[model samples]
Target chain A: MTEPAEPHAHQHESLPVAARVRRLEERVIAAGLTTDAEIDELLTRFYADAAPVNGARIVARAWTDEEYRDRLLADGSAAAAELGFGPQTSGFQLRAVANTPGRHNVIVCTLCSCYPLSLLGPSPSWYRSLAYRSQAVREPRAVLAGFGLDLPATTRIDVWDSTSEIRYLVVPVRPAGTDGLRPDELAALVTRNGLIGTAAV
Target chain B: MKFPPGSRVRARTTDPGHHTRLPRYLRGHTGEVVAVATPEPLPDDVARGVPEPRVEPVYAVRFHGADLWGCETGGHRHG
Candidate 1:
């Protein structure tokens, strides 16, 4: 017989996840447990210091400058910090894997969701899903295909399994046809998925 | 100490009752060490919320598709 329906299936359906988070933040602030200014400071810092936009910019800079790319590849922590990433304070080391003409790279944490929060912002729900964690390792090609990235079967696919000790960022090869774009403009083309190796830059 | 890049090693198939950083799928699988990341505390110990400082170097291990899955297309490798 089929198992009974979950008891909390519709209990919290009235409020979306974002709404719930907002409401909780508001209640916590109103309760005087945390000062509003302090909370605002944390929120502001999160948006500015830890976001995909920063990751995109880093990727873009590397695409344009060979020296910078070398530095980033050699010492991601220092290179990222030079750009004001300053994310290493959280104890998670950031490792960068560059995609080449013959190889592609992807990142996942199968056991637990380990992501560079201060560098790439919070992990997306889909990135942490059990399906992604399992399939990305078992059948990476198919998993990437599901994400709309169909790398040539001949191109090598490298999947980095992150742990709490370290997280990775994929540096996708620069696409053709944007020879005249400035660094900032090039960054606009880099999406979070590109940095995660699930999509092309 | 770090594993030299290109070193071939098999992930240990250990399941301590405590915590662990190695995922199950990777345990016992053979892969080539791609890069040596800076060392840090054992993730398992970190996950257990212990303040211990015991550490190990993290390595980027690249596994060939053929080594991971029996039904594979290209001989592409994944890290």
Candidate 2:
């Protein structure tokens, strides 16, 4: 007996976008513009090692080290390099915005999904969607609420629209009660959403 | 930096028929220069295929939500 059709199975492979991308890569390679190894090396260097955990490690270090926190707030790119995840790979400047009492920071690219990929991994699809790109700047409080984060009215929300080459990283306030936790332990508590300012740590 | 950190400036409203780093929503809106960003090649020139695009410092501007949306809402900083 034949199995029923599963339209969504292998959807990503069968998608038009994937086909177009493959075609483009094939054409470029056929033209001798680039080799497969070159493309794979570029991807491996830029994307393979990228993850939200990299950002968490930075936040964890900041929570544990006062001087490092100051350095991060002063110059984010340099501070990130100190932790081995620098903007050199991304070719974009990194800026860390820390959350404090009565103030919160969120990042959105109104033009496109400009994110610190070297530190935060790939940008979330929602972040790249038009709804999020527009609504995030217009109604951040409501957007944050939809993300299950309801900030008090008194809390000022500062949405950073990354229209330029500079990418933002939100340093969420260290959660209460975890004082004795080590950097690795604190890093475990740091979520991707926390790094994105969608959720707090 | 062309504008100091606290200098108030308005994003030019002139809509050039070419690529630009400034977004439409922020066009013609006034904001405070919060910081000086790295100097970048002018996008308009680069888009026009200028071999040598002029690089200039970009300012980080902070706009109040009340001003951008004409309501007492949240604020944003553009860079």
Candidate 3:
């Protein structure tokens, strides 16, 4: 195999975004502006508040109620606030997309992994990869199939490219055999991938 | 038009020196608006670290696979 081309300072092939973020964190620590404890605490709080559990809860609530579902489809951020997911400090916006028998929705930020971070916590590393960014829109059927979600060929896929500030949360179809499950139990079925439209709940 | 559902729009193709949210694959693609999204900060402003963010409307646009690829790509398998 031919050796890879030599990377230059201007080329980011040598230092990816993750490495840059880590280096920036090191500088902040080295500057003595904040301690690791504070950073860890903030990160913990962020994850706890914005994890997939929050999206699951929202989906479960929508599954159990019709009005809330309408509101969620109309204005995701406001409906999220009704369930105590208040407006984020950074003023991020969330939009909800529901899956129906005729259509399936998927999301991707091909520009740089711009996600519903306030609702979904940190995006998965897979979501940030260039493969996902470009292919999610170009070949959504194959991408979803790789994620273990085998939708029939009849289903029309609508790939939502988030090329702006609006972030999307997918409302996966409520699976069968869940007739007696409570809302929280139903929530337990929803995964981050489900909310991202890569997997079904 | 405000890009209401089913409204036709063409993605503007322009590579600038500043940060942008428009992806390369979608630069010249044509799509139809599916929904009107909440306004939020422009990606370039967010990247520049503006203290007060300027908000803009975001629309969910859907492009047809056949229109994008110029062929019937149904049975095409991906690697």
Candidate 4:
């Protein structure tokens, strides 16, 4: 008779939490602990329900109303509550930092991606890319340039380094010549770079 | 307490982390929160080990073109 296989003996090695988790997951898969289909199904359901809709609406509203826009810049949470959004997920806090003609703003996550999910919605794929993550802090001007955002020689660009505790989003000035457009229409003009303060309205 | 709308608030500079909406340039400086925008759910990865249902509201803040560029000329300055 073959000797009984040791149960999870291979997982006892001393490793970092992240590495350990990855290794254990591999073993579990080898042992058929859970089906891939089940995992995928759970993820699908989780994300489907978890997408940030309320934040998207707030961003949309800001595009339309000048008064509301002013309020959001002052107190992000209160203004969000006024719009009927809140009471979920670590309680919300809103902070708005503006980008001006002479000074530009850029945001980044040094440790990981922490974004303003409420206002800008989910971070774009580029935000998660290593190129963006690394370059954002090292040479922000170059990174912004890659995005086609050009600032005057006299303008100074300020880079905000994001850590594990805080996430930043840029509030680009409302584009010029969009005075009469509807909110939804205006939102369309708000690009990812604009929200990050790399691009102007 | 109720605060007037469009009042500028300075974010505390002590806190540091991944998802801060407050920019470094504005930490000590003050700016008005332009709008009370929308609420957003916290990212699951960050929300872990802290509290359940982490969500934050989004605000639109405006800093004067002058305030940010006061050191340089030709930029808008606060009156």
Candidate 5:
């Protein structure tokens, strides 16, 4: 067998992240640690259970219930647990930031991609990209504009950096004309980008 | 928590050349404590695998963009 490439060369491999993950899974399965079916089952359950919809559910409840909104604002993990979304197993505390008529909120991890994955599922590739991580904090308005979110000039923007063991979830303002909608319908309107603070609900 | 909410505090300046949760850009900069997170083991120690790591409160500090990058707008929340 040919010797493996050096670390520098290996880092430059053109394989996509999914391909690399599949290769790792193959190695693990070959070593008798786990079966491919078992891994697939786990992934299926994870995607089904822990997704952006979970966050949408929470936001829907908050929009309909003022008390619940207060609780979510005060203690996000506890409020999420009330709705069957378990606290993050990573021990990262979840903090919810609400957007208002005068202010908007956005989240980024300038150091690394530390997101509230249990609530928002996998982060978008741009969330972890160096360009975003650096620019989100430096030129937030420009970045938001790129996402098609152009807030009024008077609206203040709060950019949150996931620098510690605290993960943040942006609670976008409930859309107008949705007062007659049911909770589930409201939840359906909440998008992953809205929860990430890159877009409006 | 050592610093209560709304209190202005400066991130301590240090470059120990080790793993730490505190971002480098925040060092030597002052910000207001917006919230206090539950006490947890110091990440610097946790990364180093120190036995019996010391626990401490993690404050969510809000640094204005003008102070952080000399920009004329925005507020940055850093924990």
Candidate 6:
């Protein structure tokens, strides 16, 4: 594991762009300048004012409608358009990936938390923690175990570590006996961790 | 040209500039591109302290759970 450098010593102008950025981020996290609740408050305000809620509605509708789910998986942006999302500004394509018993899914941002806020709402602090990001790629089993997600030895562990160019979100499989649930009810089951593949409904 | 929506692509090693969205863990990892977001101007507030409009397209990708964390030696199945 790379030891975190002394924050004060790494100047943005001296280091490579990536390293500089990383060091700055590390400093912020190390300083504990932003509390989790404050971050959540920011996200809450951002989503409340932005189009994320609309995206979540689209996801919930798809959860209840199989045809919509097929369409969403086929053409995410188009399906999102059907629900009055992504028409002009804040252009984001929404895709929904189902996590079944056989195949599980998890998401991580190796860079920063480039989450799909449009559909999943705010990201949790753990999702942005250096511990989670670093450990996620190196020792996924141990990390998931910490999350109480113990997979069988046979299951292939595919980790999607995000880069600046791309982001990711997991569409946890709807819990059993939720076949007849409404969109609003299904939304309640979609926890933030569930969207990242750490927990399930 | 706009690639087909949901088309999966790997990041080229030569892409320039600051890339904060990509995680260090998945630098060379592979996954399916889930969606493409609208192009937005890069914010100057990035840790790099550079303020330039980005030309790269943003995407959402999916990775399998088992692919991330290895299967346990002798634990019960978890999804």
Off by over 4 Å in 4: A1-42, A49-56, A87-92, A117-122, B1-79
* Displacement of the residue B55 alpha carbon in candidate 1, Å: 2.0
lDDT of 1 by residue, B1-79 (tens): 5569988988888877886766666678888887777777776777788888578777777676676677654333333
What DockQ number belongs to candidate 4? 0.06
TM-score of candidate 5 on Cα atoms, chains taken together: 0.87
Which digits, one per residue and each the tens of the lDDT, describe model 2 over residues A17-41? 7899999999999999999999999
Which 10 consecutive residues of model 6 chain B have the lowest summed lDDT?
Answer: B70-79
Q: What is candidate 2's TM-score against the reference?
A: 0.88
Error in Å for residue A14 of model 6: 18
What would the per-residue lDDT of candidate 5 be over residues A23-67, giving only the tens digit for each residue?
998999999999989998998887776789888999999999999
Residue A166 miss distance in model 2 (angstroms): 0.1
lDDT tens readout by residue for model 4, A75-173: 666766787655422333545556666777777654456666545556665665556665565556666666677677777765555433334546666
Docking class of 4: incorrect
Give residue B76's lDDT in candidate 1 (0 to 100).
30
DockQ of each: 0.37, 0.70, 0.26, 0.06, 0.74, 0.17
- lDDT tens digits by residue: candidate 1, A1-201: 111223223222344865888799899988989977998898887767777878888899999999999998887878888887765435766778899988888888777577777767776667766677777777888878887777887888777777766678889899999999999999989888888888887
Q: Residue A132 deviation, candidate 5, in Å?
A: 0.6
Alpha-carbon DockQ of candidate 2: 0.70
C-alpha RMSD in Å of predicted model 2 compared with the true structure? 5.8
Highest DockQ among the candidates is held by which one? Answer: 5
- Cα error, candidate 5, residue A143 (Å): 0.7
Q: RMSD for all candidates, in order, please.
A: 6.4, 5.8, 6.2, 12.6, 6.7, 9.4
* 2 versus 3: better lDDT goes to: 2
Off by over 4 Å in 1: A1-37, A88-90, B49-51, B73-79
> Compared with the true structure, what per-residue lDDT tens digits does model 3 show for residues A91-187?
6567788988777888877666668877777877677777776677778888888787878888878776665456789999999999899999999
lDDT tens readout by residue for model 6, B1-79: 2544555555444434664444333344455665565655444235466565556555555543344345332211110
Which has the higher lDDT value, candidate number 3 or candidate number 5? 5
Tens-digit lDDT string for candidate 2 (B7-38) = 99999999988888888888999999988867
